[model samples]
Target: MRSIRLTRMDWRDPAFAAGLTLFLVIGTPLVPRGQGIEIQLDPLGYTLLIVSGLTLAFRRVAPTAVLAVTSLATIVYYYFAYPGFFQPSAALVSLYTVAALGARWTALVSGAALCAGLLLISFRPAGLPDRQAFDGPLWVGGWFAAVIVAAETARQRKAYLNEVEQRAVDALRTKEEAAKLRATEERLRIARELHDSLTHAISLVNAQINVAAHLFDRDPDRSRTALFAVKDASKQAMGELRSALEVLRHDDEPERPHSLRQLPDLVKASEQQGVAVKVTVSGDSPAVSQHVDLAAYRIVQESLTNAARHSRASTVSVDVRYDYDKVTVRIEDDGEADSSSVVREGVGIRGMRERVAALGGEFEVGPRPTRGFAVKAVLPLGRSEDDNGGTA
Candidate 1:
């Protein structure tokens, strides 16, 4: 009786109880009278039958009381020498309800009590301690045991089904939460990738376009160089964008992985945009992780883009230093020192900072010491052994 099957609304309880009561009230009296039946059922016997059957209406609500009332009514009716031999159906149902409600031992004991009491009515002087004398009690015990077994079986089935359904709901909820987290992470990755690559390309193209337009009338040769720079910048931008998108198309790793080795190409591209860059490399470089290499490269690239776009300076300095535990990249320009010309931090600056921070690094961008703007980033290699073993 450790389980219950009450999982949904039951509107049929009242109707079912009423029908059962009517069936028992009408059918019990019609049962053939037993041998040596001395008295016919009177108003008292009819009252007891009605009381026993009516008690079944509240079996689930008050199973113990219902069982008691029905068992008592059946016993009393029999003790009075009623002619009919049929025990009340309500007694059997209430016994089953008690067990179904998780009182198996209690229902079994009650069944024994009912059998003992009913056995007295079946005993007679002529039936002297024989097989027939025990037959009535045995039948009662058999029916009670069967009812308990059936009720217990049904209750167990309901419990198993409810558990299965609960597990399914929990699994689905967990799956949905995992999916939402993955989507959020993917969005961040894509946004960071596009902003880092495309912003640099667009800034270079803008610079070359401005140069070409200004020199179109004054110097055809210089203007043609500027136009070629514009075309190259556009092509590199598309190529980088296509490469970045290819990873998404195949849902695979990046094909053209970034490294500090690309710093030369980055410097050349900036020079083509009319910025004279002098790069300085110091210290013995050590093997570093791919993320560290990539972060260093992007920091330098974005700094060049920023200097080209914001400052009036022609010559910018790019510096990279390799240390035992970290790599640092610094870019500075001789732009005008006027406070009004200083540009505020935007998406490009923020993206560079984000990249450094993600690697547990340091980032700095501001006006230079005397007459220019500067950007610097320091990226740490956190692990003992690193992947790619890429140069810094």
Candidate 2:
């Protein structure tokens, strides 16, 4: 189909000119050439033919002007009994030129004028014939039909091409929009991962550094412990970052999951900084979705980090309660009476809330009844059988 279209376009201009020339040459032999009832071919008739040919050459460049000049010459030739073929041939080229150049009204009016000229030129005033001679109306009507059909075909073809071009443009725009949407989603996922990993690690390091700074002179051994805690936090941060990068580089690799099973290491790391965290696992840990487990782990991490940063709390409690169909986590600090004063809504709290919300869960963060702030989260564990199977 594409090759055919290319061929048609390649030959369109020359084809139109060639067709018009053939029509004129074929009519030449049919011209009546005798003495009595014959059409006379005089100098005036030759002049009209030359002018019509010149006008045909300019048909595509200036269709209306060519049609007008040819029509006027035909009318003058009628005064000297010239042949009727010249006007109809010129009008056919004029109709095609107007259609190709996006001038539909010009094509229509020129077709009408050609039909009128053919009618006048073919009329014989002498007598009616036994057999009908091809007279005015037949010639006029035939040329009108041919010209109008060609012009309408050209117009429809142009409209179809325009529609195809518009569809291609729309498809390109939709593809670009989808690509932009995917890019935005990927960025958001990366941001959430960074918040969960880097922020927790940084908070732990900051707590250890503050402890080491305080104990540098009085207790060098305890200060050494604080330094070790900072080292562990930094290593864990690098490990998580590397894991994240690995997934980015190789999408097919299975992601390693973070869960509450790692909570002991988290507390010991904080205890090294002189912050005592009391951990309790009340009910059997239910089987949970990977999304729910990750959210639970992040909530505890952010809560403990917040307590270490903002409270003079000597005792922090990390509690996990697992039910048949749900898991609940609660972190509370029993520190200075003014611990709640330092707690404010920050990115960590916002991210924890967002994570819990993503899993059809609920999160609450505010001051506890006794003292200090508490962070609590509850997540569904799917069916009871799944939750029981998840027990470890």
Candidate 3:
């Protein structure tokens, strides 16, 4: 099947029609024959001139067709030896429209053909004399060249403006895409923080709640203590959750970053779940940036949480070593570990790795040779305080 397309034009624009009407009215008059020349307007020449103007009126609708029709009429006008010194203005108008609106090759070919026909007419034996033979063609060709040059300049200017508009549209689209990506990343970071903060404390609470329920009837006093421990863990989890959510608050709201000083409290909280943890701090512990502080806290939190939840171990040891330009954190559990399963990581381990990696650091987690699981991270301190870290 063939497809048909419809187009609309503003016929209300009277510029072309009005100009054509004025040109026909003014140029159709004849000069009385005199001074070795006989100039008279015949019926055929007047009709041809009217036809050329009518064709020029529709030039914008089909410029190539209009140019061809007007050029043919012009050739006929000169062929019959019409007595007029002025070439048809309609032909020049049609040529200009074609050169400005039509394809480059079509405009060039039409202009050349029209000019060549005019040159032929200029050399007609009974027409312009020998001395003035080259005058008509030179004047007409130069004027045609000027019109073509102006049309080409307009086309180029139009193309440049279109290109600039396209580039602006592309830049806007790119900026929106970048904003969406940043929002997505912020959501992921919030999710990881929520998990890291709540997971370990919830696990501790679950363990304590189970103990309290088991001893509720038989040992009332022990059950009361277990319930109190549950209350403490839940309260701590709530505090950390509120701190993490502060990121979504207004700019004036103060943000709480989990600092290295909180490591002792984290270890004490893990001990409340019946697992013993020994923490050691070595080297001079200097003040760190906010991102590094938060990342380090999350790393230790996930490590101890994993020990409480997965590793059936009695005790875990944490070693923190701070140097002039780096901080290293290592957590090891004296738990029986499956070498095969240890090689495979879960979300907690991945989150720790992502945090360290965002700071251009090194992270490792696996089963130790003897019979335990271990996680170690070496974080560089060369970046500025303004720099931030990422989550899994």
Q: What's the TM-score of every candidate structure?
A: 0.68, 0.65, 0.82
User: Residue by residue across 1-392, what tens digits does model 2's lDDT show?
Assistant: 01101112234555555565565545654766422333656666666766666566666556667778876776666545555455456656666666566666666766677556645554557422424434644665676667767876876898799999999999999999999997776666566777778877887888788889999999999889888888989999999888778767875544556888989877986676567998899887656666677778888877777677666777799999988778899998876644335456777788887787877888888876668778899987753333555442
Ranked candidates (lDDT, high to low): 1, 3, 2
Model 1 bad stretches (over 4 Å): 1-164, 282-287, 311-317, 323-326, 330-346, 353-392
Off by over 4 Å in 2: 1-81, 84-87, 97-113, 124-140, 143-147, 154-158, 267-288, 310-392
Best by lDDT: 1
Candidate 3 lDDT, tens digit per residue, 213-318?
A: 9999999998999899899999989997887668777434356557778988888888877889999999986667777777888899999989888888789999
Candidate 1: residue 336 lDDT (0-100): 74
State each model's CA lDDT, in order.
Answer: 0.77, 0.70, 0.77
What value does the lDDT take at residue 217 in candidate 1? Answer: 96
Top TM-score prediction, candidate number? 3
> Against the true structure, candidate 2 has what lDDT?
0.70
Looking at model 1, residue 159 earns an lDDT score of 77
TM-score of 3: 0.82
Off by over 4 Å in 3: 1-27, 30-47, 50-66, 83-90, 101-109, 251-254, 342-344, 382-392
Residue 312, model 2: Cα distance from true site in angstroms: 6.6
